[model samples]
Target: MNKKDSIKACGRTINYEIVYSKKRNKASIVISPDLKVEFRAPHGISSETIRKMVSEKAEWIQKKLEWFEVNRLPDHKKQYCEGEIYLYLGREYPLKIIAFDDVKEPIVSVKDSELNFVVPKKDSEDTLPLLIKKAVWNFYSKRAEEEVEKVLKVYSKKLGIAPPTFKVKHQKRRWGSCSADNVLRINFQLVMAPPEQLEYVVVHELCHVIEKNHSARFWKLVKQMMPDYEEYRKSLKKEGWKYML
Candidate 1:
């Protein structure tokens, strides 16, 4: 069963949904990518207990909500038109489109601080947006593949562990994750971020290969790798929206 509810967090009313699950042995709370909050509890838990748990977690929940509010992407879709700014390596580059009748395939390149897209003249106006998006994604994916490999090699030597295999993927909510099998998956969107931030994520997931949970030992290892990782994490949260497209 599920029902909607509201709670007070830092004197603000935050709404969430409550789901009663027979299979759940303990209560859990989750904040979705769209910033929707949900509380899942075992069937026999009391409403009062649930409210207490939410209240106890109020500060953490408020921080997450604030982060989402600051970093959430714009509601409207991107048109990928001229003069639109795109992120690459933490810098902004304007997009420039060129049409050529002799061109057989669309080509995307970066020169003079601009992301240049050259395409067939006939399809430039009608299909440019889609083509530009695909081109941009391909560029990011390739960059992520190359950069992650380099960062992993550097950190693997320092950590004294075998380098884990990694792949670039499109992910909505997470920047990167490491599986129990030691495979690391990085969100291709990260290629748009600063190189230091990307390295921080790589180091973070590499530590997870040693410690599966975020225990004190895990963070200790992370601090050893990058003492300023906290700053990079906060920067990632604040500047993440620019790379969302």
Candidate 2:
């Protein structure tokens, strides 16, 4: 079952939806890439309880909404041109294009302080940028999967929860999301941030598998897993530009 509603957070009105699930043991809030807030709760959960939960998380929700509103971009300097800057792990890496005759397909790699793109001189001249873009996307997507797996292993063990299943994808507004089944969807762009930022997002989603809401207990679990999470959270908020596809 599903129903729509609205509430005020940080003196601003926020529209949301409630999705009822008979199999769900706890309630969770998922903010989509379009900034649509959703509440997934058990069939017997009350509207007042959900509303109170939303109200309790008003500040964080408002900040996320505002960040999404401010950070939407159609293009992010991904021209794949020579010397153009790209980020990896919160550091800058300049683009270096190498044209070779034997190269049949685009290949991208990070060597030292540059993102090396190798391409064929004949076939890919017209579609060089697109090829480079795809290569870069694959690069980050693979690294994101690895990073999520590694982080979840260490942190989930500390939190005493088995490593939950996760996926890496491109999302415009969200860093990561925790689904009702304890599955996590991590944004691939997140691999560009510093290591601590990635850990914070992973830990935040992992905590949701237990607490399910942004209540005090959920935050406490996050803190337990990452004692300096607040610093990384604030830094991520300020470095929001680094999280781009």
| Each candidate structure's count of clashing pairs | 0, 0
**How many clashing pairs does model 2 include?**
0
Model 2: worst 10 consecutive residues (lDDT sum): 71-80
Q: Write the per-residue lDDT of candidate 2 for residues 34-97, one digit (tens) a residue.
A: 5789888889877888899989888988888888788754555567778988888888899899
* Candidate lDDT (C-alpha), each: 0.86, 0.86
Give per-model TM-scores: 0.76, 0.71
- Per-residue lDDT value at 175 in model 2: 91
lDDT tens string, model 1, 39-90?
9888987778888888899899898888988887556346788888878888
In model 2, residue pairs whose N, Cα or C atoms come closer than 3 Å (at least 3 residues apart or on different chains), thus clashing, are: none
Stretches off by above 4 angstroms in model 1 are 1-35, 38-77
Native RMSD of candidate 2 (Å): 6.3
